[model samples]
Target: MMSRIPTDAIRACVEHTGWTEQEVRNVLGNVIAETPDALLEALPEVIAWAKRIEDSAALVSIMKELPRGVLEITWNGTEPAIRIRPSCDVRQVPEGWEIVLPDEKRHAST
Candidate 1:
């Protein structure tokens, strides 16, 4: 039987990133399925990224473009970065900031 997704983790993601509950579930579900604790484990970095960006709408758009799988948050350098397995392509928004997006969204109407 499949295990349920953790509500606390979902809440954290939603609170920090401004993504709807279903969006959070879609983004993190695959990773949580592979590793039950993955969402909780990654929550800190996710929150950090959200705080660093300080734009809920942008974060929501970015999350929407990510593939439906493991969400990877990295802090190996001066800033935090997020990506998913089989990394997506990136494009610059009108504000001149680059953001990653799945292939479909790469050319879809913004």
Candidate 2:
């Protein structure tokens, strides 16, 4: 069965990639910086197996991205599917994860 995706999954992915968050952040920033208009929305429900399964290697086995938004991830863990919405209430943020709300339209950057 698939596992649920947790905010901590970000760190797991970091560990699996053997890359620091700053590095990944920089890479992603560079890739998306030029295309700020790009909306790379992820279902996350697909790659959520990492939450229940502790083995990163095995986790990678069932991790597969079917499309830009859909993922087909599975592992020897319990990753129950769930509904994700942009307008949903925010869950508690995990360690090392920060929830940044979009800037107010009326407020200018300091």
Candidate 3:
């Protein structure tokens, strides 16, 4: 069965990322739909990462692809770069960035 994402989490994402409630719900809902077990475990991390980037579009793009693969953030450059990669293909995550959604967890790379 699919799990419902917590409303509080949605609200937090909206507040932190400057995205509308609907936008937060849409991205999170899609992710939860794809991975029922990841709801609670992934929500906090999602919000934290969202707060690090000022680009709502980029964050949305990252969240949308999370369920399909792994999310990789690289902060070594002048600006953070986010991307998605197949779970099986993830390498050692670099410094200043974390990899999300690998194996049991899922989400991006570049």
Candidate 4:
């Protein structure tokens, strides 16, 4: 699999979607600059595809229905047909329990 980021493709996707180019760049500017063209092209397509089915309400339903478990993505070697399954087992973390983490590990929280 290619490991480079596709800057041009990402820009095109952002532009096509009417999102501010500067905002997207501000978020992924550095990585996009270093990404491979092929990867960049693929990334935008993936984003567009994801947006088509971006169902926050469905996600909330899933979370409510399976409050005890976690969602797992099962890759099927396809470009955009990945499956997300909720774990059979309940969440490892108990309800009402807070997870502690170091301040340095705060990245990706958003």
Candidate 5:
């Protein structure tokens, strides 16, 4: 089952970051544009999975994409299906083998 970015999640972000709803909407608008509803729905799970893999940088980067740098989701041709682009230091998470990465490429995964 697919999950979506909840209104409360966005509200929480706005409250924590002190950003206006419009600002949040602008970023979310771009996000929706790129991947559409399904991926956005999967955002929370994707983030949790990223945390499980210790890819905090990626999570932060995804959140910081005001003008750009937004997490770009794509099909990996696998069951994990969704792939996040602009992933810096790619590391594979065993569950569904999702590729998670930090913001910068410090070391290459072998």
Candidate 6:
């Protein structure tokens, strides 16, 4: 998948979103140039298609209604989807937020 951080796309997002172009450019450029592994690890979390984490309260309600266990959230990004293992007990998901289930223990994948 093509990354959204391409120069023209980033410039577009900045102009469309009314964000500081300089800030966006610096953050995007530095992440691409400095720490590749960190960027790879976090790419799934903050892609262009992530259901804007800006709406947490509503998401909490949605999570509360869904049956407990693993949920796969498909968003637009290079990879296209992210699977989250949320804590079983959560009633409402914090909106615009996908909190990593606190009790989730990451087992090394083979």
Give the poorly placed runs of model 5, Cα more than 4 Å off: 1-4, 32-110
Error of 6 at 89 (Å): 35
- Candidate 2 residue 31 Cα shift, in angstroms, is 2.1
The TM-score values for the models, in the order shown, are 0.35, 0.23, 0.38, 0.28, 0.28, 0.25
For TM-score, candidate 1 versus 2, the one ahead is: 1
Q: Which of 2 and 5 is ahead in lDDT?
A: 5
If both were scored by lDDT, which would come out higher, candidate 1 or candidate 2?
A: 1
Q: Could you tell me the lDDT of residue 24 within candidate 3?
A: 73
Query: Model 4 Cα displacement at 11 (Å)?
Result: 3.9
Q: Residue-wise lDDT of candidate 6 within 25-105, one digit each (tens)? A: 554554543455565455445444332543455566666664445456676864335445544333456574444344433
What is candidate 3's lDDT per residue for 1-110, written digit by digit as tens? 12366677667777877889887766666553345456667876766665565466768776785554455567876766766655545446656445554445532333
Number of the candidate with higher lDDT, 2 or 4: 4
lDDT of each: 0.60, 0.38, 0.61, 0.48, 0.50, 0.50
Per-residue lDDT for 27-66 in model 1, tens only? 5544433355665667567556654556656666876775
Worst 10 residues of 5 by lDDT: 101-110
The TM-score obtained by model 4 is 0.28
- Least accurate 10 contiguous residues by lDDT in model 4: 82-91
The per-residue C-alpha lDDT of model 5 at residue 109 equals 26
Highest TM-score: give the candidate number.
3
Q: Give residue 22's error in model 5 in angstroms.
A: 1.2
Q: Any runs in candidate 6 off by more than 4 Å, and if so which?
A: 1-7, 33-51, 54-110
lDDT per residue for candidate 2 within 1-110, as digits (tens), equals 01222436546656765657664344344332223323123323322333334355554453432112223233446654433324323346767433333344113322
Q: In candidate 5, residue 37 scores what lDDT?
A: 67
